[model samples]
Target: MTTELLTPAEMADLVGVSVDTLRYYERERLISGVGRADNGHRRYDADDVAWIRVLRCLRDTGMTIDQLRHYCDLGEQGVTTKPERLAMLRDHRAKVEARRAEIDRALELIDHKIDIYLNEAAGDAP
Candidate 1:
């Protein structure tokens, strides 16, 4: 199998995150097992990139740092942790679904007001 690796900047670009963020993740132990180049520069492999993408997704979806850390901790244990990870993801999914439902309600109200404004403009509203 061919192995792919990226420099810090390349990893950041590929992950759509800043280099500082990558360093921060490593420094904070949110990610681990990064390789070092001849010059001691950080090099990230495909696994690292994929992991960072997952981290970004979770963070973007409003997962708290402590929750994220817990998820990562469980993930570090490998397959035996699969069930725990599944449970955590399921819980997070429920929260996301609930938030989406709330947003849908707000959007429905906004659409209703827009309809009223349009009707009023067209003199269709009494």
Candidate 2:
């Protein structure tokens, strides 16, 4: 039983990131334990894909690089650090929620402005 490994190009395409980004993450210590092929090229397995997806999600949600480094450090320490990771994730989620609320307010303001402009355009302004 074996899983086919992905080339850097393939991994980048599958993970929706550039090959440079994959290299950057590897260099940044955010991605570790990457397997190497006989030609010494990086080969990504299913586990690598799953972990990179997690990294992408955290980054998309605005987790800072420093925060990600710490997260990855804990992850490297294995399951014994789950509690700390949970705490950090909880904190990050709170910040994301707060930012979401702020964006919601900004969106409401934008919608209001759009409605006003639309009304004015239709000669329906008060």
Best by lDDT: 2
What is the lDDT for 89 in model 1? 93
Model 1 Cα lDDT, one tens digit per residue, 35-112? 998899988888888888999988888887788888888878889999999999999989989989999999999999
TM-score of each: 0.86, 0.92
User: All candidates' lDDT scores?
Assistant: 0.88, 0.94
lDDT of 2 at 7: 95
Candidate 2 deviant stretches above 4 angstroms: 124-126
How far is each candidate from the true structure, as Cα RMSD in Å? Answer: 2.3, 1.8
Model 2, span 13-42: residue lDDT tens = 998999999999989999999999888999
Best by TM-score: 2
Q: What does candidate 1 score on TM?
A: 0.86
lDDT of 1: 0.88
